[model samples]
Target chain A: MARQVAQRDDLLPVLAETFREHGYEGASLSLIATATGLGKGSLYHFFPGGKAEMVEAVLAEIEAWFEARVFAPLRQDDDPAAAIAQMFGTVTDYFRSGRRVCLVGALSLSDARDRFGQALRRYFALWVEALTEALTRVGHPPEGATALSEDIVGGIQGAVVLARALDRPETFERILVCLRERARAA
Target chain B: MARQVAQRDDLLPVLAETFREHGYEGASLSLIATATGLGKGSLYHFFPGGKAEMVEAVLAEIEAWFEARVFAPLRQDDDPAAAIAQMFGTVTDYFRSGRRVCLVGALSLSDARDRFGQALRRYFALWVEALTEALTRVGHPPEGATALSEDIVGGIQGAVVLARALDRPETFERILVCLRERARAA
Candidate 1:
């Protein structure tokens, strides 16, 4: 049975899951309605701009979550190593240890990128930036830190792809461990 | 007008691009017909099993191309370092320096993965395996070689995602250079 959503914000996670499961193009309004237990009328009332608006709200929520939980900590926390460690843990939990898809990354690969390109770009760019700051704080040189941050961020995205493709969550876990070690040694 | 395709094999690339542009679910029959300049009847004549068959044929073509161009050289070439270098070159060209999406990687992230999971798994597993062999031959220890192969393969896939997300082909190009160097150092 579909669960009731009490508020507009309550729909964000459900919408995000729908997008992750079926992708932006595949997630039909009907599928979303089915997922959220909301009729088309109610859905329209919540998101007058339709699926695009719903996705936008979802992306905003995701960005906000990352900012508070991952990015801000990476940038503002005094313990650089601990902050990086926390970032990895938060990411692991967020991605459900590779069982969940990165909706932004998935959309970036699909035609929806043409429409939501800016949001997608910002999601990744901010991640790389925040991580670069964290790495630099850990005493790595700026250029090397930037490159390593990109590698770690991109590596996480790719590990999710591979783990899902190979149906092996261990693959994701193993890569995360390696990445964590590399960051520590950096 | 769509270019004439005299052979069944000729349709593979068009199908691949259609899937890349629109994704598996988004690439409907009409869109494919429009892309190929073929009517419904002709498309059916060529792919009696419909879109699924067409996708299967495309995947097969991709696997064959990689096997001959990338995997075979990595596994069989006497100069492992050169083979690894050639793999990077082939991959960069194949992805069109990040302008082109990795269709297999994209599929692995979408709902289509439920249907094409095995093929997706084999595609990546084989690449990692072949590259591991090349790295080992290049003098890296067996365990390290395998892990490094995973990192490099996953890095490429992630780089593609990041490059497209940011609309910066240079992101992909830079990562490829880094991965190439990493492989050489390994």
Candidate 2:
């Protein structure tokens, strides 16, 4: 039982990578099994709920990483501009490290209109709310700051899409820089 | 043959709707066949290359529609703010038509890294260039205008995702209003 648990733990990262690469529908159980060196039956043994459970686990892992590496740093500061710039760095690090599509964006592409969708929605809202609170702390009106936060987050997400499409990180960096400057100006 | 051609023409919109609703990976041949009232064999009959070809056709159809509805209006006059606002209105109409995800956004979410990526890049470049040219035509510096255009486009795409997730059009409208105001202030 302990060995089985260890094996499942080892499988999670590989499964996350596969899901990130091909998305939910495109990533097959066969691919996950192959990547993890597990048979289909073993994969089922680990995740009885199958692909959905695997994806949910992957999302939770990514979300935790995002919170620790990205959101936590931003929430530590009160300077809105600095916090905004830090968030951009987090985004850059995320894409560079994972070479993966944003999980939220990926799930949004599916007919996932279920708990997965709700989780993604809540995740984004939390990010926006965190940024908005920081901005409000820095003296920007709550409404404008929230709007700005939304734009900044949105711009980064869109820029990632463009960057991946063009195979150019510079595009993403340029957009982030643009948003940072705009935030500072505001 | 003429009847077959007409039937094929009628089929494109149905296929496009399926792709738009469920995305590329989530959109299966079976679902598309059901939606279009065609059997699997009949779908294969029309689309010899199957799902990929059907997706390619949908992309083409969407590209044409986008160019007409979104891009064409921007070229009507050189007033940057007016053109940008009008472009936002086009996006509003496009999203409000009950299509939850933009084709470009949806394509980016899929493993479209090679196949449809360049086209998506070109479409975005065209959008940014149009806005940049308009802004530059109206006296903003080329660099600043280009960055602003990126923010506006990115914000709109992000706003759409948020709006769809929340099931509210107002979220998108609010973001667009902020974008327009930022453009005017710039």
Candidate 3:
């Protein structure tokens, strides 16, 4: 029983990695089973709804990880300028850690448009809202702050897409530098 | 012979629509065949390299269409601010025209990352270069203009994803308003 629990615990990261590499439609149950070294039956035992359940678990794991590593730091830093810079660094690290595209962004493109996409949209809105509030507290007007917040978030995502295509992290960094400067100026 | 040539000319828009709606990976040759009312053998005959060639043709066609309808206006108005607004309008129209995501952005997410991805990257760089040069000419420093240019482009792409998810085009308009205001301030 202990071994089974450990195996289940181990499956999340592997599944996240698989989803990152292959996307939702491309990542198959058999592929996840093989990667986790669990038989199909064991895989079914852990995720009865199959791929959908596995993806939900993956989304939860990623959301928690992002909240701790990315969003949490923003709350800790009171200086909006510094917080913005830290946010960029956190995203850079997250992307570099696994050389993965943003899972939420990737899932948004799926034809299924499952609950996974909804969860991702919610996470994005939360991040934008948090950033908007931070900028407002820093004295920028609400309109400007909200707009800038959205632009910065959007730019980071675009940079991620470019970074993946170019196989270089610097593309992401260069765009982030631009956004940081804008935030500081504000 | 004239009737056959006319038929081939009529097929391009349908083929382009298929590529736009389903994307490269999600779009199958069989579907294209059905959409175009061309048999599989006919499609193969016209596009010997199969889906890749067909997709390339579609992308090229769309690029030309954008240049004629979208980028052409930028050249018409030498006033940088006017040109930028016009550019935004063009982009808004393009997105609204078919509720389509940028094909380049969509293809970048797929496993078929080769020449197609490279082509998309080049097109994006071209856009940035044009916008940055215009901004620089309008008195903004090279660095600031380039950074802002990237932010605007990236923001628009991200907004498309949001718009699709929410089933609302207004999300795109909000992002556009922000981008235009940022440009004016810069």
Q: What is the per-candidate TM-score for chain B?
A: 0.96, 0.85, 0.86
TM-score for each model: 0.97, 0.88, 0.84
Instruction: Give candidate 1 misplaced runs (Cα > 4 Å).
Output: A1-5, B1-5
* Model 3 C-alpha lDDT per residue in residues A1-186, reported as the tens digit of each score: 335554565789999888777766677778887888787889888889898988888888887887776666555566766776778778778777214677777666556454566777777776777777767767778768867777677667777766665555666677777777766644
Q: Which ranges in model 3 have alpha carbons more than 4 Å from their true place?
A: A1-6, A72-83, A97-99, A165-168, B1-9, B72-81, B97-99, B165-168
Candidates, ranked, DockQ: 1, 2, 3
Encode model 3's per-residue lDDT on B113-173: one tens digit a residue.
5557767766677676677766676667876787667767776777776666544576678
Best candidate (score: DockQ): 1
lDDT string for model 1 (A15-97, tens) is 99999999988899999999998999889999999999999999999999999999999898989899999999998998987
Residue B113 of model 3, lDDT score: 52
lDDT of 2 by residue, A1-186 (tens): 323445666777888778778877788878887788778878888889999998887777777877776666566664655776677777788777224577777676567645588778767777877777766666677658877777776667777666665566776788777777666644
Best by TM-score: 1
**Can you tell me the CAPRI class of model 2?**
medium
What CA root-mean-square deviation does each model show from the true structure? 2.2, 3.1, 3.6
Q: Model 2: runs farther than 4 Å from truth?
A: A1-7, A76-83, A97-99, B1-6, B76-81, B97-99
Interface root mean square deviation for model 1, in Å? Answer: 0.7
What is the DockQ for all candidates, taken in turn? 0.88, 0.57, 0.40
